[model samples]
Target: MPFPFRGFFLAGLLTLLLISSVQAQSVPTVIGARATLEPWSDPIEALGTLRADESITLSATLTEIIAQINFSDGEQVEAGQLLIKLEDNEEQAQLRVAQAIRDERRNALNRASQLLERNLAPRAEVEDTQARLRQAEAEIQALQARLANYRLLAPFSGRVGFRNISTGALVTPGMALVTLDKLDIMKLDFAVPEVFLDVLEPGLILTATSAAFPGYTFQGEIATIGSRVDPISRSMNVRAELQNPEMRLRPGMLMEVVVRRRPRQTIVIPEAALIPEGERHFVLVIHEEEDNRIERRQVQIGQRRPGDVEVLEGINKGELVVSHGVQHSREGDNVQLLGIASDETSVRELLESRRGQGDS
Candidate 1:
């Protein structure tokens, strides 16, 4: 071969190599992301009502005059705390008399027992004194129990409602004095369709929201499910226990409930990464190594959540998929990976974040 012709051949080979390199570099710049395992679930929505864990109406058990009011309206009280005291002067006097008589009877019984032991008194005399002592003790117990009936006490740790009577007010048995509610823990009652009866059970997690306190959510777990479903509505009553550390929730407030069921971890990708052809769906998956080429693979999808789609088949966890530029790429085509997408943010937001990082 001629030397000039050989030089031309070498130059032509160099030119081809340079052009190929440039074409490879210019292939498309698109956002790509790894298929990630995320929690997926079918959520059941319902409405619920809030109630205190314990609620009761505090009332007087005996007819008496209110001697003292120990608690104000809406006051927080501990278990067995005295809330109101009725006039107990008569009971107190009777109790004191019974106590004195009891002491006297006890001394007599002791003396009789000593005498009997020494053979100075008959055993029948000792038995009579013992019987008198027992009677005195029984009288004291009756008086003490009567005194307790005059006072209204909080049965549990709770907040008291409005006081219905004042000091020196005459009250009768079963007269409403006030209301009390234990607010540390709340009970939420909701109804769910009987169709979910198979999955409905205690210990399932649920969340609730109230229009009264917008943007705040309460977390709880199912505590009880009704054994019988309502025939007319075809729903079952469900009760949940919610923590009330701050006591912000009150009884009778309406709540919105969301019960999560069938939770599982599965491979998921951004909805934008999927390309639909009629009823079929496809995603351009990037090769793990060796090349930046993509494969347009058909995927079987399941339940869809906001911003994400579950890949039932044809995709594996940690495999990269084209998210932003699927319209410009083809199968087996090499492309530029602009950045990795995420379920936390959209592709455009990811680009903005990168631009911000570059500016910073």
Candidate 2:
């Protein structure tokens, strides 16, 4: 072999080694998201039962036969609306006789007063006539009161339940005739641990969901907090009122309630960005100014929500952290930015969207 040819071969071999090293150091592509300031809240969950704002069972106070049924099953009625008419023929006839007697007594009293003024009647006679008129008036009032007991009127504006009696059906004292409920607003009764008593107060916002109404969230505010906590459960009762103008909510419906508390703005990042090693969490943050190099950082985490986590420390707003391709990333390694994730779109979704665009 010639000496010059040997030297050229050695140089070529060196050049190839350098090229391989450069290729090995090539930046790996990764999906990342910026730590952002977002509104965060602590949620306290509980179970509750729904009740009507006002509810009552209509009943008869006296034994009587129903003469007319003014409403049908499940009818909406206004306050003071006549709902049932009981047989009051005897009371009505007695009232007419009493009224006539009162009218006659009043005429006699007026004549006695006139005679007394003319000195033709004694003062005692006028006083006696006045007493009789008073007695007659009282009798008429008593008969009218009795008649009132025969008529069943709605005490409040609400929807009526199934009628228990029909025309000519006899009802005794305390007999339930129907049910009435004001469903414009619903009351929810729930309990939370006594530890949350400090935060439990009227006007705290809550959201409720019922199995009977899937995907429908009922919004309400706490109306009252019980004065005492339950000794056995170590929980306090809470009552919330929900607007139910459509009457979709009914009494005795079981519901799941979540009360939001301690809301604040905090730094947040995608949950996928977190790498767990025992009790410690780490994230690979991207530094754009330094050729997109990653920095491994130990982070303190607080509450975690779906798809996102609260970053208590070790990150700031606008700092990008690797969300996808985290397994392939390490500290001080250069990375190629695939895309940035936003609150509306997750890292995996964003990667898929980018892939779709490339395919198009």
Candidate 3:
């Protein structure tokens, strides 16, 4: 059955074994990113609410019929602008009567003074007439002061809200007529943990964002800090002022605030390199160990930004970390380094591009 046939079969079996061994020895390729040292500014994030710099609800002081309404709804008014006028018909008649009596008293006082100068009337009589004329003038002044209450004037310059009462409607004292708010500048109030009290100060730059306006950021500064921290919450209240020329931010709007206290230099790495398990984090670090092997090292992380995370410990500058194909890697496994990612933005873009491809 022959020696030549047996030799050919053995040679073919050896060739198949050699090919399988070569395929097993081939290294797995993976993308790696280096830890970089960059200038990072730590941000104190907090929730806040926006408020108008100045706000007031206008109301009447006296009960009377509204004779005239000068402003319309949502109107911008100047300071001391005449906003409403109440009917003052009776007050006007009373003022006229008081003026007429004052005129009569003045004529009597003049005659009495002339008589006294001619020695026909006593000095007491002239003094009494002068007193009567002064009393009449005082009465007229009091009446005029009372008439001022019938008119309501704007206390400040701002935009006015809608009024509930009409021109002829009778409004009582303390009834709300309209609301006025100065929206040129807005006040943002927020609370931060008491630990940040030392860094909190006026004029610290901050940025705020709201869900109402996506992708838009409003810049402001810390205007004031509360004097005392709340005993219950253990947080201090902070106020910031923002210029709202466009009036896009309204009062009572919820905002996400980020206060940039100062800049710091720290180690950062691409977020894709981080592997979180439970409460701990790990990364596959590629180093020269029998032809570039991966070492699973635990890492301590800090504040995170877009596409990058702060590496507080367990990693050093310029260390190569596996950014892609982590699932195919293990500790002490030989890997082929395809490319080193230097730019964090590019790494993020590459990850997103891959994710998009997978999704499709």
Candidate 4:
């Protein structure tokens, strides 16, 4: 080989060795997370069924053919409105007899009083007449109550179910007349794992959607929580109230309930930066400013959100956290942020992105 060729080849060989040495000296890992202030309110999921706020089965007070069906089946009835009428002609006649008897007793009692005052009638006769008058009045009231019951009236305002008897069909007292339910407000009954029993409370906001309702969702709040946990199922029963002004929701509809807790500002750290030691949590945080440093921070955990855990203490917002190679890092060490190759935040972003796609 000529002198110039040998020189160039030797130079190239030296260059390759230098590059290899540089590559061997560096190690890179993905650093997880971006600094974010987490809001409180963790996401909770549970399954349940929709129920009516109020439900009742109606029965007749008298045994007779539904004489007159004033209100149609499945109609909304107001409180105390006449819903059905039994054969009340007999009741009306009975009421008239009672009234006449009462009137006669009253007049007889007045005459006996006047005759006693004149000393022509005994006081016993006047006392007996007074008792008869009171007895007659009580009989009148009884007949009036029976007469009123002959007509079935709505006990409360609600939507009526289908009628079992027609105008001419006979229905005995306490028979299945129909059902009345108040549906303006609906209830959702569900159970949550016993592990989460302490975190749940009344008035917690809940969002629910059902496959039957498609894209529509119902918003509600925890109305009641069971006092005791279910021993057999190891779950807690929770009830939520949702508005149904349009009356689109029905009883017994299945739905999923999402309970959201109260929101408060909290410090958050990426999951990759967290290290567990003896039931305690620690995070590797990068010290920013003069002479880059690293520290192992003991952090208290609170409500956890997606991809991150809320740090109740030991970390602040906007702090530089070392999420990569945290296991190998020690506290009070000189660390350069760029020296470690970072892929941690990107991995989380990628997983979240794919999750969004799957959900859609």
Candidate 5:
């Protein structure tokens, strides 16, 4: 090898190293957001079922032929309103006969009393007539009481379901006649894991949603909590009451329930800022001094929401964090901030905007 050739080779190698160092020093552009203190709530989610506040299946207590149907199906009825009538011709005739016998006995007793007072009749004969009058009066009262059963009355104010029996149909004892539901308020029943038993209490506010009504949320409060937890499922039953003025929520509907336990101030950051490496999580915190250098810090994460995550440790309020271009950032690397994300921008919206830019 010649001396001149060796020197030329060394000079070329030094030029290449200088160019690589300059490229590494150039700042990489990234989008970032500042850690913020926000009101955070922990939500307990569970599936629930809706029920009527009051419901019953109306049935007949006696076997009788229906003579008339007083109410139409699905009609709203007030308490004590007559809903059906059975054949009562025989009961009416029996009542009339008992009344006639009662009148005769009363007249005989009065005549005997007057004779005894005038000294024309013995006191023993007047006493026998009085006893007969009392028995007749008892029969009349018994007959009247039996006649009242022939008409069926509503037990409470509610909406009636379709009647199963028509006019002149014979209905046996305990046979279902119709269904009544009190729909002004709805009862929501749900079960929660036993772990949450300590937090369960009456008057906890919750929001419910059903597939039947998309995007509509029904608000309710916890009405009761079960005293005992189920051993098999390790869950406790909870009941909540919701006012249903529109009557749109029906019984047996499956609802998604969300109970916000409590609110607290916590350090929150955009979900995009998190960098997961196996079991550990990290974020790139940017320092504005000295050409905007980035520092990698491990974080302890807590509850996660739609577009943000709760930072339990390793982060502070008002610290700049790299939200976008996290994959391209390295520790101690200089970065140029393209934009500082507003607190209102969600993780989903941020992802969509990045996707759109990639597509263009």
Candidate 6:
């Protein structure tokens, strides 16, 4: 069938309208930003755990059975505090015998030398007495050392773990008496990817928090960074020292850490302004004119914080960016500047005020 001139004109107009609607892009997307400046700080977040810097398993240096458990489990003990006492009766008895033998030998040697000087004893006999005295002295020292090994004393000031044996129980060498840990100063051990290696080093400050103790922030310093990165994880071990003078922090509590690498003044835009589609990211920048009509311009992005992203390559200062209603306008379409610039300013002010509160 053939259409008349009027019908053909009407069909052409409808087709044009459909094509334009399909190709239209959005404009006036919600926009906001923070004032920018030159600074050099990048904050890297990490997960770690609280741990004691020094921990060891207390064991008997010599073989013996457990006699009396001196310290209670999980008790804070001082340096050289009695932790465990083993069966040492046999050792003490032997030590007494050894002391007697040494004393007797020493006395005999003195008497023999006196007699030799007086020409009353043979020279060979005096020499034999001297030899016996030396042997006896050596035996006494060995016995005293062995006797000291029966009792286990805390090597350093720390908290003792569970008692591994009850009183009168028999234990041997290599048997674990208890665990001890010095928790006054804790080690915050964690790992960071090699990509961030340059930003971390000794003396840098850090703040950490734990869910166990809510709202309490802990402070620390970067004490060590491993020289080599692990091949499997491509991460290097990092250690921070935290003062736990009250001994309130436990040895294995999970932690969250934020290490500031670089601090720089930068322009930050609201995340709402960003329009992400597949691999590409963009934002609807505000185009102001004398007519008060809003227009759109695309922008690139950099890093992101809680609700803002850094402007890396796109946009500039004093330029307005439309954050809300970006899906409605186009490149040259006329838009009413529904609100004043103060709307964007208020949002930025809110974020800064919150940050200030945290600082106080």
Best-performing candidate as measured by TM-score: 1
Candidates 2 and 3 compared by TM-score, better number? 2
Give stretches of model 6 more than 4 Å off.
1-41, 61-63, 122-124, 263-360
Q: Which stretches of candidate 1 lie over 4 Å from their true place?
A: 1-27, 288-291, 343-348, 353-360
lDDT of 2 by residue, 176-255 (tens): 99999999999999999999988777888889999888999999989999999899999999999999988899999999
lDDT of each candidate versus the true structure: 0.89, 0.91, 0.89, 0.79, 0.89, 0.75
Residues 99-212 of candidate 5: C-alpha lDDT, one tens digit per residue: 999899999989999999999999999999998889988998998788778888888888898866789899988988888889889999999999998887788888999999
Give the alpha carbon lDDT tens digit for every residue of 1-360 in model 1: 899999999999999999999897769878898899988877899999999999999788878888889888888999989888888888899899999999999999989989998999999999999889999999999889888888778889999988767788988888888999999999999999999999988988888999988999899999999989999999999999999999899999999999988878999998888999999999999885847888989999998877789999999989999988889999988887778866476677878877997799
Ranking of all predicted structures according to lDDT, beginning with the best and ending with the worst: 2, 1, 3, 5, 4, 6
Count residue pairs with overlapping backbones in model 1: 0
lDDT score of model 3? 0.89
Each prediction's total of clashing residue pairs, residues at least 3 apart in sequence or on different chains, is 0, 0, 0, 4, 0, 19
In model 4, residue pairs whose N, Cα or C atoms come closer than 3 Å (at least 3 residues apart or on different chains), thus clashing, are 30-342, 30-343, 30-344, 31-342
Candidate 1: the clashing residue pairs are none
Model 4 per-residue lDDT at 97: 90
* Rank order (by TM-score, best first): 1, 2, 4, 5, 3, 6
lDDT of 6 by residue, 74-159 (tens): 89898888777778887788878888988998899899999999999999998998899899889889987776687678888898
TM-score for model 2? 0.84
Model 2 residue 239 CA deviation (Å) reads 2.1
RMSD of 6: 12.3
| lDDT value, candidate 1, whole model | 0.89
Residue-level lDDT tens digits of model 3 in 17-80: 9998887766676888889899887899999999999998878888999999999988889989
Which sections of candidate 5 miss by over 4 Å?
1-40, 100-141, 263-302, 308-360
Query: Between candidates 5 and 6, which one is better according to TM-score?
Result: 5
Q: Among these predicted structures, which one has the highest lDDT?
A: 2
